[model samples]
Target: MAPTPCITVDHLTVNYRDVQALRNIRLTVQPGKVVGIFGPNGAGKSTLIKAMLGLMPVVTGRVSYGEGTLARQLDRVAYVPQRSQIDWTFPATVWDVVMMGRVKKTGWFNRFSAVSRRLATEALERVGMLEFRDRPIGALSGGQQQRVFLARALAQQAEIFFFDEPFVGVDQKTEAVLFKIFQELAAAGSIVMVVNHDLGESITHFDQLILLNKELIAAGPRDRVLTRDNMTRAYGGHVGFFGHVA
Candidate 1:
């Protein structure tokens, strides 16, 4: 039998007032895998992420972790929100931001101690941002900011990670670096899932793809589920042809 999935969603549904954002969403994400969720704007991609984290209250159904529920296992997961969602002008150093990840592990009594500082440093080093650790977050470029957020997640040392639109405005070099970091995370047995919109080109970097258009259109290995037929179905049959990757 297949290894038990690290995360599972069963018959999940969400709504905003009378507007249905997600309808009967279901998926299982295995450990050490890189999964991509692709869809156009207003396709409920963000709603899925928010609902899983309890950022969006669900109207019906359940979101579970492994066989247990999401509420009990919040510490095992780390979230990296879309770059656009954050306020860059926040007065915090890169190191300070990363150190926030250790808050859960430090518990309620102990303050951030030497061990927490070390872990923060290590997370910055892992993301190649240690040299800029002292810099204020507002001083960094777009790519550097993205790296900092990732380092924050790394510092959490969680088994599962959720990234929303990580490549939205990154330079090509930053995109490449992020991909390398993702591969490393997966190799080390962590689940790395990202929500992206650049489907025609971004599918090459993913091992599995979950297509969404208010519901799960298709999900499986990249080569099997990202074909033209499925693409047409998901994107309304009028997508522009971007040349294939050689």
Candidate 2:
């Protein structure tokens, strides 16, 4: 079999009202790698992914997956937004949330198939949330909530995964579980991209890095993109390497 086609962003640009959020961004996301988007506050890390997925309006350029644009293949993409963006008290059970992932496949106004239910159950079990399936989403801890969302994504069985700030506020155990699953997904030939703000040890988990500061600072393997000069350009100062400050 031939290699899977990579996701490509060509001369992408996005603006928010009068403010430019991202400018002339270009990158290729290959299958079977965990690519991290890193930057300072308001550096457009989230904006870039959203634009690539066509969740946000792009002022210029385009994002293509294989030979097709992302907008045309959204069913193959799974996105988990920041925890802060979700309403915890939405009167939904954990099972309800996870099953939502099947909506695209199940079709509107159609009941989920038995296979879809089985997939959702397996996803919850993988994330260790099966026992709490009937519990309200609001009753879960921060880590539990994140795990539930992850389960939802897994149930989607999407080829491309986009996670925005998945590590923020999650417990250490959740972080470990999440990274393990991410590695598994990459190993299985999926595209995984994470938008992360932490400039600490967790940065080591990514195979590739896309450093941004309202524009493309650098994009490559972690070692090549995490250089001192790139860090200074993206963050406007020196950042600690590994676990030590410069």
Give per-candidate clash totals.
0, 0
Per-residue alpha-carbon lDDT of candidate 2 for residues 1-246, written as tens digits (9 for 90 to 100): 455679999999899999999999989999899989999989998888889889889999999988889888999888999887899989999999998998865665653788889999999999999999999999999889989999999999888899999988889999999999999999999999999988778888999999999999999998899888889899886676664446
Per-model TM-score, in order, reads 0.92, 0.96
| TM-score between candidate 2 and the true structure | 0.96
Q: Tell me how many residue pairs clash in candidate 2.
A: 0
RMSD of each: 2.7, 1.5
**Residue 13 displacement in candidate 2 (angstroms):** 0.8
- How far is 112's C-alpha from truth in model 1 (Å)? 2.5
